[model samples]
Target: MPNTHRLSPVPSTLAVALALALISPLASADDASGTTPKDLDAVVVTASPLKGNTESVATPVDVLYGEDLDKAKAGTLGETVAKLPGVQTTYFGTGVGRPIIRGQEGPRVQVLSGGIGSMDASTVSADHAVSIEPFLADQIEVLKGPATLLFGSGAIGGAVNVVDGRLAESIPDQPLSGRAEVRGNTVNDERTGMFRLDGVNGNWVLHVDGLVRDTDDYDIPGVAILHDHEEGEEHEEAPQPNGTLPNSSVRTKAGAIGATYLGDRGYFGLAGSTYRSNYGIPAGAHVHGEEDHDHDHNGENDHEEHEEGPVRIDMVQNRLDLKAGVYNPASFLESINLRAAWNDYEHVELEGDEIGTRFTNEGYDARLEAVQKTWNGWRGAFGLQFGSTDFSAVGAEAFVPSTVTDTLGLFVLQQKDFGPWKLELGGRYDQVKLKPDDRASTDFSATNLSAAAIWRLSDGFDLRFGLDRSERAPTNEELFAGGTHVATQSIEIGDAALDTEKGVRAEIGAHWHTDRVDLKLAVYQTKFKDFIYLTDTGVEEEGYPVRLWTQDDATFTGAEAEAKIQLADTAAGAWDLRVYGDYVRAKLDGSGLRTVAFDVPHGDHTHGYEVDIAQGGYLPRIAPMRVGADLGWSLGGWRASLGAVRYSKQGDLAQNEEPSAGYTLVDAHVAYRWDRPASSWEVFLDGSNLTDEEARPHTSLLRDYAPLPGRGVAFGIRAYF
Candidate 1:
């Protein structure tokens, strides 16, 4: 058993009080001045190659920046964006999480840093954390649907881009400008601080940013395990006491520095960053048996014994990025933009104080895009992208073999406007080579095509349709892994013969906008020729269940809808009501032809029953349907919101899978800002799981072992100059 001690909440209470004190005066000032808040439209950069706003994009996009981002930021990327429609988080304890978009995760959804691949091993495993930190980001963009034309084969499902101004593309208006923030949370006794500084001297722009965060084990509402009993059932072990979860602490530090030379025609910049983290993995899951030992004649142990302790991960990453852009050139291309990044990442998994496994990845990605002036009423951009990675894992838990992968891709995007309609077309071709140190090399080539149209039916309504055929090559982990994954408590086996996955996606959506109302509804379906997924094998290896990476013809269908209504605009505030919902259903068509065995009877008309090998099964770990609503009020420099999200019970299950009960989580936030002549300061309070609901995300394999954090309040303050 693990320790059950809890941290005092005195600091949390003080932080909350400080925030309220800062906000009360602001609210009073707003009332005396009788000022009203202004609503501003948001701009998104990941939707397309060209600049576009959320309302103008052909597909759904969510952008978080400024005060909104600070209020919503969490320890992990998944939790930061979990409230968005069609998005769910796969929580691996409190230390690691990645977003699950539209029922797709792993390699299908790409996590990017400034429009390029993050070059991290997050996709290789669920317990791996994304390299980017939300605190240091200037903006985070979530682009829904197929984005292969823009990002590459890895973005067959969607893409999330974290934009940090480390490599400054443009110089700031002021010579020196920066921002700083401090935050504290009660649930985990977490404390965080971050700052960014930018200075310009003689056309040379310099940037520096740093962040530090530390947290203890998080508190929970109830016992770690729940037991159900009937009138005639045997009783098991009693439930553990409600307290903090053991081995759930986290500590992280990151920093970056960069410089840019800004000329009249173009700008070029380079940046280098380093990140370090040490986090404890949640305990209470499966534990392997101790190694065998031979006793001596005197009853002494023959082998050394290692102390048992919580599992943890110590990770470090060093990265460098180069960015350049030219406003105009004398060649055929009107302008050009270049971006490249090189990353060195490594992490060690420690059991107690002993290292169990170490993972390393060294990779580089480069892309060059050229824009052309309007030619024959069409505007477009063409780009070439290349990337290579060498990855290895060594130790007792080395599940996958060392591998090297190289990829090159070329893509073009064009758009034309005719009357009240706009048409966009794009195509990409990628060639990938994967070589395992101990296995035969495999080569894959894929061609992806996309088309979209937006037609204006009236002044405030638009209809959009999109079609895409995207292809993705299998990853090394999916093709070569064969070992136990301790975090998930499962034995994983991979199939080397799996083919590339190809998907055809069709989407139709409608957007309506008015001074008082904004609405969007989209429906989409994707059909795959070879959909790769992990399936339970109903077998056990070393006391752990087995999961095999397999491929099958599958289909995924989903819908998303959101509406925002402006109810009132008064001196007290601008009140708005918003409602959003999303759902996805994925199923395998049928079981392919495979060999099977059955019992035989002698001299009987019916010898035995035929068994169907794993066919017509639902996809595992898909997020349950969700519906949510929120009310917002903003006046002057103060803002407040109250919301609730209701997740439907997930009864649909694959073979040997269990169902998860439905849950509703309530959340609220309040913020106030104070503006000065040359600077601004803001304080906010955020509350989550106010009802203390026992919620478990169905998208996570650790749902049975770890539940979501309960009844937490956070206080934060930010300053900009």
Candidate 2:
């Protein structure tokens, strides 16, 4: 394997390893097979279509497990994920946030649950929140970089997979298990109620989950953050009962169900989900023109120019999954497997009178995978997939013009162990078809390939290298849409002759772990040809921003680092600490036109850190670099935890640049449980932004419109039955 020692900071790497080696004498002399429960186990994530340990995968993967979720006191999938590296959100306020990966926003990113696309309008606009709740998730996986193959052509940038219990139905011999939870937040008067159930017995197992949330308009720390034009605003009509309101109430309901059958050889399952949302939509990002003060008569007739209620969207979708595996559980062929799923989504926006526009997408995906026993110390997998989608929209501003697309892909991956070293290589080929309704059809084909290798030189030292090439086609929205979206008020125009986007990325990393610390560093670069961008010409249509979606050739490259240390390990109580951060420089290669996404007149960089307490603590968004300490005690049948996060303001941005200011949000969490696990229940008292810190998320879409919600307190109960 290529030497990746260059990825790390020489001194820190050596110091951490030596410290751990020194402390090894105090640790129990356990076998190298990782037989102790106290040792950290490698997490299984869905970065590759198949399951792979995080440490073994060449690509960068960030995971948020159960304890991590509790620390954040997060309500939605987007809220919890915003804390990970290379992940941010375009917030419509504190209540509505959507994940943005490496500056790539909108439809280019896909959100999934149990490997199937999340059937919601999250991608339709920035103001719409994802229908899936984070509370029910066992873990949230963020896959960064060209992860489009197993997902779809849409994920040119990357994807988020929310792992819930719905897929656990495939497991046999497990009894029905379920949990219930309720929470309330002070910031927006937000209250949430949710429940989840799972079961597996003999030949049949089932899973179901649901959630509902209601809240009033959120409160900002100061005067509502308003554009210069709307600050001293004057209106012709009278206002409603809600304070400073324009239809900004929040309400949502979602439910999912799945069933699986296990036979002597393989298993097949079916899953379906329905999400309904009727929530408040905030005003546009920009409020133009000066405030006119004629009081009652000023601009009374300009009704078309002013939006009355928050933009409302309703989305409904259905999905089905089928799988079959053969060859019982052997040393290698855990069994050959095949899986398929079909999803249909409908999205619509509503104003006072007219249903602005409607979009419907029907998609189907299927894949077959096989695992072979070791051949010369090497094990491998070969897989094939076929997927197709049809989309259409109705109204004056139709973005998706009734198009059908199909893709066929095949791939092979092999892993081998050479003493303490391991190697993995994979390659895939894809053929894509695009047929527009009554338009010139386009048939395009491309090839994708990846290779990675890992070397374990010593007990605490590891080196890894990876390279991949990928391609992506434009979505129906990018190829046909032409209209003014109320949220950002950007006049969007699509191109019919746009070509496929292609690129290659290479990365190298060094990882070391010992008793005192665990540290990792990685560097990567990507070159793109025929890249796509939506360019803003500093123009507007009737006060609405205008931009054209076009293609360009460009390049982006950056580096990242993560580290964790055991500051103090003691018998009375252990004090363990962790820290993680990354810095990225993304820009256009030629003709600095700011055409590439997130690329602008100025270069951009994002960084943050978390100092986790041993017993437990809070993990807020932008969780300032903190110094926290906690204690955990267990006596025979009882256990408890208490901790705090001393958050500090990092920095702030100008009005037009980003919405955020320095502030501290203090928070604490306490929970208790019994030894009779199955019948025991725990209640948690959680406080967030405890300092009542009123701040804004720099990545929020509404940064210019309002501050982050004030302190929120939620009491929740978790019961397993």
Candidate 3:
């Protein structure tokens, strides 16, 4: 169990805005012709698997678009997603990170690509990085709360989907389109280059993309935790550290190709990608703090040098997706569509081929939907989905004798739009069977239901209420995971008879938007009947933390708010400011059940803030709060833009008793674009963390042992043809 600490009132993080106003500089750019409206663009979010307003959906969703990525300065998908309201990052170091959703990690949250399941082994462990690259993505989506209906059994916590590859819709009529960029950063002394190219000829479209990144040991802003060892205290310190990166330095490379044929009826595509990396790892806190202990026992030597090694990971994945729809031509029964996908994934770890392990997973999913035009103001979708997975592992860490699981589900959904009011109802049924290579098979089935409503009181005012019941079956890992988890220094144990987890989630929310201001607020609560978790016994039973996977009944509740304000907008440019935050309280049943595996005790809270400003403000990580401006001018046949992002410190973490400190990161970018003939190119310079301020981010889960690297600089060139 975690050492509990007395609680403190939630800090007043919003007060920082007052201080920012007193320190920021004024915008100098002005409208050249003064004819354009000053209103901000209407931001739309597709959070649900179906189409709906972000504010009115029955489920909670966070949307990150390409523009949002620029403001975040996040190098990877894991880092960018951590800035969401209920999301957090568990960092092994700067190089390795996994998103923790509503306090659930690993398999609980599913990762997808292009609307289909991604079979990567990311869910198998925390130290592994997801293969998707945010830099090459069109958008990143978060399906917060229970998403068991759209995804399969593993989606009780939530889901993340990275939308990349070529889209039949985004393709231009000019036959070819592509973008190329180069960038560099200081923290890890890292450099990256990427290019995306696509071409359309008749009914065929082809796309190819690639990215390469490499860095040396990152430069630490503070003392290094791994180097603080005492030679003569063998019993004091924990086991070996996990990753290879010393400080923040890490390496990554990826490439992908996709092709599609667009016919009169629909479109189908095939895509494949490969990712490789070698990064640093930090020892668990329990292990790091005991390095000074003195022990002389069992005729054993007390002094031994700590061994440091990098964790190596490689992944390859292939997917096929098809979307087909038939239009009614008439208003009634407007359209019927079907979506299907298949994926194959392989992940391996190596300390050299002789050591480590490998896991392979393959899955298939298919969904059919029918949409109807309402005669009396009602329209929605009804669907059915089927999915299954086969998993296996080899080498030292392999779990069971390879297992296979099959699942089938059916769902019905309907939406009614009544002027200012909207209502939706959905229900799902699932049947699953797990077959092990050498054990009796387990079979289970569950049903889930959800209902929600929204009221638009006015042009810019809205209110929403939602409730849902969800269920999730155990994965192969939770039923058979064995051996030691090197980073956590825990001898992991699994429970085969664990029952399915079922829960109720509810939320009430409102949103207000105007030409100059936008605000959103929501209050949510969740109750779980059987929650799977890990419990610590505080004993080194097998040379590590004697921890076992368990389950219990629990309750959780929280509230969240997000807002953005338009400070200025003119024909020349515009600037804006934004902020967001959330707080949650979770507790187990009245039994006072000391601890259950993987469970966080009650009264835990998390919150964050962002400030941003620009002709077009951007916040990638936490939807930054900015106080800056943009300037644009035309010189000859070229247009130039200059902008700056003054990012505030990342927010505090709920899981940590003593949270890390926030820092100020200042970045500047200048770009010049050329307009000549049918081709154009852009050249720009970007400097991040310009002030060299020390900041610890949630993405750096190993902050106590590894601080982020300081200042960074990068130059890049982009072109479109």
Best by TM-score: 1
Question: How displaced is residue 158 in candidate 3, in Å?
Answer: 2.5
Q: Model 1 over residues 469-505: C-alpha lDDT tens digits?
A: 9999999998988776766667777878889899999
lDDT of residue 546 for candidate 1? 68
Model 3 residue 48 distance off true place after TM-score fit, in angstroms: 4.7
Regions of candidate 1 where Cα sits further than 4 Å from its true position: 1-42, 226-241, 289-307, 591-593, 596-612
| 582 Cα displacement, candidate 3 (Å) | 2.7
lDDT by residue (1-721, candidate 3, tens digit) is 2323123113212323432242222211222232332343433444344565555564667777643554443655667786566676666666566665665567778887766666666766656667666777767778777777677667877888777754444456678777777776555666888888888877878889888888777655544564444355334444443322243456777777777776675556666666666554433322311223323233223323322244455566666666666667346776676667777777676543333677788888777767676657666666677777788878755644478888888877777777788888878888888887868888878788888788888666678888889898877667776555554556666777889888898888776655555566667778888777655544453244545666677666656565555565666556555555554445555442243333211124311212111111111122112233333344443443344333333332221123345455555655667756877777766665666655555334355566555566666676767
Whichever of 1 and 3 has more TM-score, that candidate is 1
Q: Model 2: how far is 345 from its true place, Å?
A: 2.2
Stretches of candidate 3 off by over 4 Å are 1-50, 53-58, 226-249, 278-309, 325-336, 373-376, 399-401, 570-573, 591-680, 684-701
**Candidate 2: segments with Cα more than 4 A from true spot:** 1-38, 46-50, 94-96, 119-121, 169-174, 228-248, 285-300, 304-307, 328-334, 352-354, 396-402, 569-572, 592-666
lDDT of 2: 0.61
Q: What are the candidates' C-alpha RMSDs?
A: 9.7, 9.1, 9.0
- The 0-to-1 C-alpha lDDT of every candidate, in the order given, reads 0.80, 0.61, 0.60
